[model samples]
Target: MDDTSFLGSYTVGTDAGMCCLWQPEHFAHVTSYDVWEDALGNDPAIERSIEAGAFVPLYLHSDGVYQVTLRTGARTPREKRYTTASSEPYLLVSKGAVALSGIEAVGADLDAAETIALAPGRYAVEVHLIDWQAEPGSTDADGNAVDGALPDFVVEISPEPDPAPPYRRTVETFDLPEE
Candidate 1:
C-alpha cells in the first residue's frame, strides 16, 4: 500500500441535495464556513447551528472578541463547524518550516489556556504530548505527536494571517469602575 496517509482526500458537494461532497457526518467531525455577514449576533439563528463541533472562522478580528456567523443555504445544508482534535497535539513541520528570525514558542504538552496568554507573536511550539496543530499541517493525524518522535512544530502568528490567528484568541472586555 502507498503511504497515502500523507495525502488528503477532501471533496466538494454539488446539488448539495443531490450529491454530497463528502459525508461530513461520517467523519469524527466537520468544519463549515460562515455565511452570515454579522458574526456578532446571538439569536436562535446563530445559537442553533453551534452544537458539538466549532465555528471555524473564515476571517479574523484585528482585535477583541470574534463571532462566527452562518446562514442556511444549498451550499450549507447543515450548520458546519471545525472539529478540534482535543484528544491530541499539534502537527509537526520540518525544522526549515520555522523562520529563524521570527518569534515562536517551543515546548511539549503546552496547555491551550497558557498558549492563549502569549502576546501576538510567531512561535515554534513543541509538545511531547500536544502541539495544537492549526490547519493544513494539522490534517495529518500523526502531527499530534503522541510519541513525541517529531522534532518541533513552527507556527506564525502575524499581525493578521490569511485565516484566523494561528493561536486561538479568548479576550474578554470589562467595564471600568465608576469614579
Candidate 2:
C-alpha cells in the first residue's frame, strides 16, 4: 500500500533567488538579506546539514514563481524526468504551523500566505528540480510551455527523528550583495 499522502501545494514567488519553509516565530528577526547571506552563507556545516536533511534550503538558479508541493511519506516520489537535487532534515519548532514564502516575505503578514499546519518536530524535506525546457514539447500540467526557464522545485516534508548533534548550524556573518 502507498503510504504517501498529499498535504498541500502552492505556487510561491521569489525575487531573492531563494525560498524557505520556516517557523515564523523563530524567524521574526530575519531580514530580507539574511536569508541568503547569513542562513546559507556557503559554510561547510550548512552544506553538511543540507546533505543530512537537517536544514531546508530551497536554492533557485534564478528568481520567479514556482510550484511547491508538500507531502508526507516514507518514500520519495520518483519522477522519470526530474532530478532529485537533495533531501534534508529540518528541525521545525512551532506552536503547530510553519510558513512557506520567499526570503523577502518572511516577516510580512502571512495570514493569507501558504502556511502549513503540523505538529512541532523534525521533518525531512526533499527538493526536486524540474527543467521543462530540457525536453522538447514538454509542458507542465497547466499546459504552459516554460521554455528555457529556470528550474522549479517540489519539497516533501515528513516526520523524522532528531538528527545527531554537531549538525546544528551557527549562522555566520557574510557581506550582503549590492542591490
Candidate 3:
C-alpha cells in the first residue's frame, strides 16, 4: 500500500490547543457555540459536536505551531516511523470542500486557513504520532524541531461509507467527576 498519496500539507497555529477539518458551510453551525474553548477544556460541547457530525475536532497536546498533512490511501506513511495514536470516524455534512484551521481561526482569522475539496460524506481519520525519540537532536522529515516532547500528528483521511457509530475520542484533556 502506497502511503505517499499526499493530498496537501499545512502549517497551523493553535493558541487554543486544538484544530479542526471542517466544511465551510457548517463553520457557523459548529462554531455557533464556543466549541474551541470546550475542546481545550474537554467539555461536553465538543462531544456534542462530534456526535452531531458537526466537524472533525482535533485535540492537540500542546498549544503552538504544528505541521498538519492531509493524505489519502494508506492510513500511515511508510517513509517515516509513526505509531497509530488514534483513529476516529468523521461524518462530513456539507459541500464537497473543507478547510483545515486552528479552532481559534473559525470566525476571526479563517482567511489564514488551508482549504481542500473532498466528497462530502463520512470519512475515517487516522492520526499518526511522529516518533522523535529515535533522533533526539534531529528534526522530522517536514523540518519540524524534535527537541520538544509534544505529541504532534499526521492525519490520514479516507472515504468510509459506513462508519460505525459511537465514535471514540483520541485526546482528552480533563477527567469527568464521578456522578
Candidate 4:
C-alpha cells in the first residue's frame, strides 16, 4: 500500500507517485490511482523551448475543454510538444473556501511542488495574473498578423524535464505514530 501526503515537509522528502500503463481490469477494486511521469528533470523542456503545447490546464474531478496552450513561442505543433511534466509553480487556489489544503497530483504528468492537498471546503482557483511588458504582435495560425490586444498572461511555476528535479523521494513502509 502507498502511504503518501501532499502537505510538504522540510524534515523529509517527497515520493512522486509512479505512473504506469496498467490494465484497468487487473485492479478493479482500486478506488483511484496516481500515475506520475518521469521525474521533474533539471529543466523542463517547455521553459525555454518555443513549442506551444496544449493540455488540460486546470485541476478538477473531470477535465474540462482543453483551453490551456502553453509555450507560446512555437509556430507549429511538431516544432515543440508537451513531452513530460512541468514543475513550474502555477497558482492553485483551493476549489472551495478554505485557508489551507493539500493537493496531490495523480496524473502521469502533474504535481504541486509542495504538498498542499486541499482541505474540506471551497476555493476559487485562479492563477495570479502577470503583466508582461512587451511588443504588440498580432498573428493567426496561418502566420498572419491579427488585430487585438493580448490579455495579461499568468506566470506559471517553471516546469522541469522528465529528469528528477533537485529533490529526493521514495516509498517507505513503517509504523504509524500512535494517537
**Which candidate has the top score in lDDT?**
3
lDDT tens digits, residues 1-179, model 4?
11131122111112322111111121223234422112212124211110111111222223211112122122122212321222233222232211111112322222222223343321212222122223235356675435432222211222233452332111111122379
TM-score of 3: 0.69
* Candidate 2 lowest-lDDT run of ten: 167-176
Task: State the RMSD for candidate 1.
Answer: 21.0
Superior candidate under lDDT, 1 versus 2? 2
Clashes per candidate (backbone, < 3 Å) = 16, 3, 0, 33
Encode model 2's per-residue lDDT on 35-57: one tens digit a residue: 53564455573554444433355
Cα lDDT tens digits for candidate 1, 1-179: 22321111112121211110111122212122222213223324322322211111111113222111111111111111122211111111221121111001111212211112222232222111112233234334654423322222112222222453233221111122379
Q: Evaluate model 1: give its lDDT.
A: 0.20
Clash number for model 2?
A: 3
Each candidate's lDDT (Cα)?
A: 0.20, 0.56, 0.60, 0.23
Displacement of residue 168 (Cα, Å) in model 4 is 36
Greater-TM-score candidate between 3 and 4: 3
RMSD of each: 21.0, 7.3, 5.5, 19.8
- In candidate 2, which residue ranges exceed 4 Å CA deviation? 1-4, 29-55, 74-81, 132-137, 140-151, 162-179
Model 1, C-alpha of 119: deviation from truth (Å): 37
lDDT of 4 at 67: 19
In model 3, which range of ten residues has the least summed lDDT? 168-177
The superposed Cα distance between candidate 3 and the true structure at residue 111, in angstroms, equals 0.5
- What is candidate 3's lDDT per residue for 1-179, written digit by digit as tens? 55356776677888888777766665554353465455434556555555555557666556887767677765443325554355455554536777888766754335868878777676666555555444455577787666543345566677764535545543342222379
Return the top candidate by TM-score: 3
